[model samples]
Target: MSILSLQGVVAGYGSAPILNGLDLALDEGDIGVIVGPNGAGKSTTLKAVFGLLAVSDGCILLRGEDIANRPTESHAGRGLAFVPQEHNVFRTLSVQENLDMGAYVRRGERAALLDRVFEIFPPLKAKRAQPAGELSGGQRQMVAVGRALMSDPSVLLLDEPTAGLSPLYMSELFDRVVAVNRTGVTVALVEQNARQALGIATRGFVLAGGRMRFTGTGAELLADPDVARSFLGG
Candidate 1:
């Protein structure tokens, strides 16, 4: 069964819907990438699923249970985690403290999870005591992702993870994303770097005008002449 599925999801800031009858699905352990032009509802999809926006219509299912219109906190408690594109971390908090905050909803010890987060992002281990704002853009992004991972989520939603990083850092971040997914967490990412994101994705989705234009394996989308010409910049 799919870990998360969106059926006819219609959502937006107010009443003007951004996601027009959007449908998406992801199985456990799959790295799914959503790529499209600006205003195509790539980030909107994640926001809707994360409950950052109200769903005006349709349902969002987590393991087949309807979670549409549920609060964001409730979704987190249900093993769903989201790392948004910006302002994702507490700038003044220490790296370790930021991670600790991510586990606020959990009821048990989180030492092991903390250790694992540091393991996944080794740079964080060395700067655990430093404020998140003192870190470079890439390291801060790592902190944001590590913070979300502290919750030990079953599904992770990332929006524009590599938005403003240098090429080297962008590549490194993608490697870390792959590393995170290797631990059996399903990842659904909305990325601006289409080709690079799709290269690492198990599945790729192309959205246009808030609707799915193409869906296939990453390799298939990369190799298709039409997809390449239109969305992949030829």
Candidate 2:
């Protein structure tokens, strides 16, 4: 069974729906990438699923349970974590402190979780004591993702993770995303770097005008000539 699925999801800022009957799914341990033009509702999908926006219609299922329109705070306990593109980390806090905030809902044995996140982000281990705002953009992005991982989620939602990143950092971040998936976390991410994002995706979705125009394995979508010409900057 799929780990997460959105069926005919309709959501928006006020009354105008940004996601118009949008649908997508991710299997266990899969790296699902959503790519498309600006205003295509790529980021909006993640927002809707993470409860940043209300689902006016349709269903969002997490491991077969209907979770649409649930309170945003309630999502973490249900094994869902979201790392938004902007203002994701607490600037004044130390790296370790930022990560600690992610586990606010947890009880004991937090050390192991810290170790796990540091293991994935070795640079964070060295700068754990430094203010999060002092770090470079890539490191900040890492902190944001690491903070989300502290929740130990089964499904992670990332919106435009590589936005404004240098090419080197973007490539490195993608490597880390693949590594994260290898550890059995189901990932759904919206990326502006379509070609590279799809390269690491197990499943790839091409969204246009708030709807899925194409869905396939990463390799399949990458190889599709039409996908290249229209969206991949052929």
Model 2: residues >4 Å from true position, as ranges? none
- What digit string (tens of lDDT, one per residue) describes model 1 on residues 1-234? 999999999999886999999999999999999999999999999999988899999999999999988888898789999999999999999998999998887648589888889888999999999999999999999999999998989999999999899999999999999999998899999998999999999999999999999999999999999999999999
User: What's the TM-score of each model vs. the native?
Assistant: 0.98, 0.98
For model 2, state the Cα shift of residue 217 in Å.
0.5
Q: How accurate locally is residue 136 in candidate 2, as Cα lDDT from 0 to 100?
A: 98
Q: Give per-residue lDDT, candidate 2, residue 125.
A: 98
Candidate 1 error regions (>4 Å): none
Residue-wise lDDT of candidate 2 within 1-234, one digit each (tens)?
Answer: 889999999998898998899989999999999999999999999988988899999999999999988999999999999999999999999999999998876647478888988888999999999999999999999999999988888899999999899999999999999888877899998999999999999999999999999999999999999999999999
TM-score, predicted candidate 1 vs. hidden true structure: 0.98
Every candidate's lDDT: 0.93, 0.93
Model 2 steric clash pairs? none
